[model samples]
Target: MKTYDSISAYIEACPAEHRTLLEQLRAIIQKNVPTAQETISYGIPTFKLRGNLIHFGLAKKHIGLYPGAAAVEAFKEALGAYKTSKGAIQLPLEEELPIGLIEDILRFSVAAQTKSA
Candidate 1:
């Protein structure tokens, strides 16, 4: 598998159609967590504040947002429309990206990370 050196590179490596959506997600994360550090972790884009805040990547049919299990559980009710696993949430590309929900998730992640730190 190919490895990306940065978030922009990772986003660029994805299919052309997914670029805009990935960029939009990146912007939402950045906007919500202004002080978080951006890096390529596990070959995907990750944000870190006190520690890892969130990671996001493009999938075949959706965008995967990894805010860890606690955040996923915390927002379970709000995320009922999307497919979620232990630590990830799948935001389908065909539907409108839930920017508000994404922002809320990011904020919750930042707060949780901060509290833990």
Candidate 2:
């Protein structure tokens, strides 16, 4: 696997089409928790504030946001519009990105991580 020293490097590695989405997602997470450290975890862009708060990546047709297992469960209703699994929600590339919802999830995730810590 490739190793990156920073978030900018990781974002650079992504395809050009994914750049905007990645940047948008990165901005939201950073805005909510500026102290969070960015890293490439499990081959995707991950953020760590108090702990492993969230990880996101570009899929063939969507962006996959992994906000931990608990966050996925808590927001399952809101996430129903997308394809999801135990820890990820697939936001389709062709659709308008749900920035607000993503922010809420990130905020909740940061709080959850803090509580567990």
Candidate 3:
């Protein structure tokens, strides 16, 4: 599989009407966590700061944002409407993804990582 070094490279490769939205979300995550490392894992874009913090990807129906186990547990109520696994939360493209909620999740992920270490 092709891997991208920077989030821009990933954005440039995305093809769809939602490309802009995905890129915008990526930028928001990067902006809020400037020190995070960008990488592609499990065919998804992931950010690591101090430890693995989050992962996101585009799907045919929605965007998959994995904000770690802690975030998934904390946001269970808000995320209950979507399909989810142990470590991922599916945010449909039809719905306006909650940017503030994602940021808070990132913050929580950072703290979780620190606590575990």
Best by lDDT: 1
Runs in model 2 with CA error above 4 Å? none
TM-score of each: 0.96, 0.91, 0.87
Worst 10 residues of 3 by lDDT: 2-11
Per-residue error for 75 in candidate 2, Å, reads 0.5
Candidate ranking under TM-score, highest first, comes to 1, 2, 3
Order the numbered candidates by lDDT, best leading: 1, 2, 3
Q: Against the true structure, whose TM-score is highest?
A: 1
lDDT per residue as tens, model 1, 10-95: 99889998899899888888888888899998879999898888999888999899999999999999999999999999999898
Which segments of model 1 are wrong by more than 4 Å?
none
lDDT of residue 74 for candidate 1: 96
Please identify which of the two predictions, 1 or 2, would achieve the higher lDDT against the true structure. Answer: 1
Give the worst 10-residue stretch by lDDT in candidate 2: 1-10
Q: What's the CA RMSD for each of the models?
A: 0.9, 1.4, 1.7
Candidate 2 global lDDT: 0.85
